[model samples]
Target chain A: MAIKQRKLELGVLVASLALVTSCKREDRPFQTSAPSAEAIQFTRMTDFRAGGPSISGNQPSPAMSADETPEEKEFEENAYMVGEGKRLFSAFNCVGCHAHGGGGMGPALIDDQWIYGHEPAQIFCTIIEGRPNGMPSFGGKIPSFQVWQLASYVRSLGGLVPGDAAPGRDDDMHGGPPENSAPNQKPNDSSLPKSAEMPK
Target chain B: MIAAATARWATLADNDFGVTSGEWVRGTKSVLDPAGPQSGRIHQLFLDYFWLSVVVYVLVVLFVIFAVILRRRRARWTGPILAEPAPSREKLRGWLVGLATLATTIALFFLLAGDHAAGRAIRSLSTDNALKIRVTGHQWWWEFRFEDEAPSKIFTTANEIHIPVGRTIEVELHSPDVIHSFWVPNLHGKRDMIPGHPTRIAFRADKASEYWGQCAEFCGYEHAKMRFRVVAEPEEKFNAWKAAQLQSSVQPATDSQKKGQYVFLHTTCVMCHTIQGTTAGAMMGPDLTHLASRKTIAAGSLPNKRGHLAGWISNPQTIKPGVRMPANSLPPDQLQALLDYLEILK
Candidate 1:
């Protein structure tokens, strides 16, 4: 009778230990898998359709999902997210210091002189951890997903590709005008330049 | 006693009362004469307005006193007596027409004169070369950058501006943050400095002198403390001073200086100020690259000395309340070292 009782106690102890070990395993951080071939293909299609560079793994679109319906997919691909980002950018008064993309008190976001990396994650980090020189940290003010969308809009301004976009094709996104033209040229022409020449 | 009190009040309002005895103030009197060439034009306009205002005030005061004294005792109780009203419509019309014509003429003259003066000050090309200085306004301080100099040759001074005597000095104003106004009473009027917009002001001092200036606009809580000094020196002395300011800071020779440099890097100072050629590249605050070269500290509110610098670094808020610069707590050794290092800014 005593041996049978000891065996039951041991069985109960072993079961409790096993349960604790499983719970610890569940607490481990999630490890994401590397971008798959299918993901890359889908990103490229979206980038090409959007008239941007082929998407890379570094810049995965936040809304990229294979499970979404056709209607949902159309909304993600169109100007809805970009429009939301534009509204947030103005609402937050980013243009007040940035001055319509022209550098002023703050560094120009539209220009190529990015102190932080141009990647979405990098841009998100910058907004989260504000840089020196009068920039405030908006991590608490803005939601994470909204920050990513804002980053996407800022990336789009210089006409850079989204994540999963092809590299070395930045020139294809130049829809407005060519490199050089007279200062007083018409805006509709492709020959209009980007900026005025510096004083001699 | 009442007569004596009245006499004392009258004397207190005289021009000679409470006059400053500083050398700078005396020099400014001669150099920045209200009757001088540049100021003379503006001076006349101001005088005309001043006399007009004085006359109006005197007439109003006299009328009030006369009406009070000449009032009938019975008339006080019986107000608005029943009597035949006089016809004053033609007189009223004539007065209105005369006043309108006079006001219009005065307004037109002022507008044209002001426009002409402003045009001459900003755009007129002078045969005499002007001394150019780029003045960048930060939150509560001024950064003076001289033109026609190399990167290494660049000198960053605060608050005090040094120009040669008898030369037109052109100040190109730019603001890094909010709007700031630059004004010196004896030198020139206030000019607004807008972000992304640069404005220029031109003024000349006839003699070697120092003039006081204050940020006229309500910029921030410490706006009143944001003062500057314009030091117009002899041509040769100005050149020498500029050469000295242009030179690189002397290296830290003592152990205290080395320790101060270490403290500067480890402290909050590194987060806001920049000491050029060092890792402190922060543009949020005034560049302390050549701090020792400046004549005054805390935006000209205090003299730049070892004790004041230490006090300022220790508790800036106590000296200038609501200043954006935070007061940093430091040990005695660290504060001493920092002061030692800063004293060699030239």
Candidate 2:
């Protein structure tokens, strides 16, 4: 009987040690450095399609988009970064066009449909480099680190970020449900279907 | 040690209160110094109430003392006495008590009548075309909107209120958040500004002077610092001020000013504040069209100096904690340019 009790005690100690070792380690918000361009990767329509439309205007044409970098990992996991990004979203006048992701002048960010790729790398590129019609380029204006933070926040709006890291409600008017309570949406790349018509 | 401390306190008190002259000390915002008819009526009512209470107290105390003296003189011995009370004496005491109660009731009735008369005078203005100004009370700030029939003529300003002297100024009070009370002791009594329930208060300033007004209600953080100044000026001066406020922001003349304007439009400043004739039109914050023209900034918490403005722009949290305006991380050159641009806003 004494031997059985000793075995049970040893089992409980080993189990607790495993649980502690598996606990998540969080990086402080706004403390990380910007990731290198080589770290970012994503899928473009041109890469998948046999023949696709060429990139138009002064818009940037990167190879592809959305393979999570270590810097992005830090942003999506930190709750403070998400909250700070929500504040910056208003301060940078993102709500002026997006209107809390419901889409006024710009397209809705909360919806599943992504004109560009729905990956974090793709979102970061779209903000840093201006799109065709209305989306202004904030490359030289906002710091690169802040742009990454904003991308993480945008992902949260679509219920893409982790639930624990998402922001809560604002002190102002109750516009809609908060980002944390947002339902998960599977990203659908709409650009792939219309990629066959190539521009000379 | 205690005696020494008391002696020092007595000397300090003597220095503060001891006077050779018979002149009364009147504060700049004292209710005793009536600048309008509304305050004058209130002052008179307060005086009447004060003197009436004093008279009643004195009479009661004297009557009690007189009764004690009479009873002592009429007593035969100091020990317990066996004496029958007279029916006439009891009847007289009943009559006296009834008379005192009647006098008190009459005094209260008179005060009620005075209060009603003051209320009527405060509500009813002599002229039909009183200047209408809508005051919206925020957490710790005041927004004043001067209404007009024409949209072009309508303008909004904050903190400092200017009105033409000798004219009834009608103010409609509103609150988007918690309850606040607006009180200009020199001009009018405090009136509650309840959220969702609009209230109105009318008063006319007879004197051409500046009077300070403060938030009478206990609001959230920095409530004590929530203050404004009422400038009662001549009709011509008031109109000129109004005309200047109606105009849009001026175009930048210097290179630094242009850079400053660019900084303001491009940064978080544009996200909240509005500068007329500029693309930075957002109503979430105050309208900075005529900001430089105003005497103070941050809802009259700080003087409108370049140093103060710089400190406020860099870190407003340190100066006024929990304010909605975030700290802008602008370089020295950009901050200087911003100040130059703002100064020309007048």
Candidate 3:
């Protein structure tokens, strides 16, 4: 009976250890781990040009790929990063022109039409180098990591990122439905002028 | 001890106690200094209540002593056997109780009437020709927007409020995030600024002095740091301040100041703040058009000095944790240039 009792105790201890080890642990609630600047490479994933061919239908453009880098995965899938990016969107006054993605001074970010390519790299370039006319360059202003986060949030607004990673109802006045409910949109080829300049 | 307390109360009613010392003795000055007409009426009622309470306390203490002495005398004269009181003594005791009850009733009735009158008087303060100001409470700050009939005269400021002495100022309160109480104890009482529900209060400062105000309600993390100053100055001075606030930002005259302006426009500051005559015109944060004119920063958490401003820019969370403004890690040269540029904003 003593041997059987000892075995039961050892089994219980092993089960508790397994349970504790199985649960993921983070040092802090929000992931502040900075993404490497060089981790984003979209050349193979997207056939992006200054004025790329436009396609019709609900299908993703032929240039799109299924593979995603680890950095891109964290940016697009991590709930904390996406939530922080949503806050940055308002803090950086993106909502001033974008007006919660419906767009006022800037184009509607949630729509399928892409004046520039809708790939993650394309969006990053747009924010960093800026487009012509109304878009002001923020290359040297905002930190590169924050620009990446903002780009990830913009993708989520278009329902490009997974729904679970998107933000819920905000405390501010409602401009549209919660971002988690954003309808899925397929990225389209660019409609920019052929001679339109592109960021290096 | 009672006399000493009353003397202290008298000093508080004078309004000169903290003015000369330049130190705000929070509760005493805030409650007793009646700088405005509305607060003066309230203060008078409060004094009446204080005197009545003092009188009641003295009378009650004297009655207790008399009863104790009478009991001792009866114990000495009467034998060890305790007998019931005579009919005459019982009648006298009944009369004393009835007199005490009547006195208490009369005193309470007087106070009730005075309170009703004071409330009516506070509400009856004139709104005609009163300057209209809209106050919006944020998570840990206050925004004041002045309205005028002319479009050019309208301007917005934060933290500090400037008013002309002897002129009634009507303030409408709003809160975008949470419930916050607006209170300037010397000038007026507390009013809650609730989200979606706006409130209004009016008062006229008869004295030209600085009165401190703070958010009385318990708000988020930095609620204690949320304070403001109300400066009641001459009309001409107030007009001049308003005119300066309405003008566009001053042009950078020096190279450092110029660099500072460029940095401000290019950096994350422009994303939240607005400065007139500049390309940086977003409204997520306070308007810093006349920042240098204000006496304090961070909703009066720190005095508006060069070192404090630098520290605040370097790390706001150190001074006020959970503040929405993030820390900017700028190099030494940029930080100094920014300070120089901000200093001339007055």
lDDT of 3 by residue, B47-143 (tens): 9999999999998999899989888887789756357777898899899899989989999999999999999999999999999999999989999
Q: Which stretches of candidate 1 lie over 4 Å from their true place?
A: A1-200, B1-40, B59-82, B85-128, B149-152, B276-281
- For all predictions in the order shown, the interface RMSD in Å is 15.3, 5.3, 3.6
Assess each model's interface with DockQ, reporting 2 decimals per model.
0.02, 0.12, 0.27
lDDT of 2 by residue, B217-307 (tens): 9887778767777889999999999999999899999999999999998776886788999997776577899988877778767777788
Model 3 TM-score relative to the real fold: 0.73
Ranked by DockQ from best down, the candidates are: 3, 2, 1
RMSD (Å) per prediction:
19.8, 9.9, 8.6
Query: Would you list the clashing residue pairs of candidate 2?
Result: A41-A65, A41-A66, A42-A65, A42-A66
C-alpha RMSD of candidate 3: 8.6
True contacts kept of 3: 0.43
TM-score-better candidate, 1 vs 2:
2
CAPRI quality of model 3? acceptable
lDDT of 1 at B316: 81
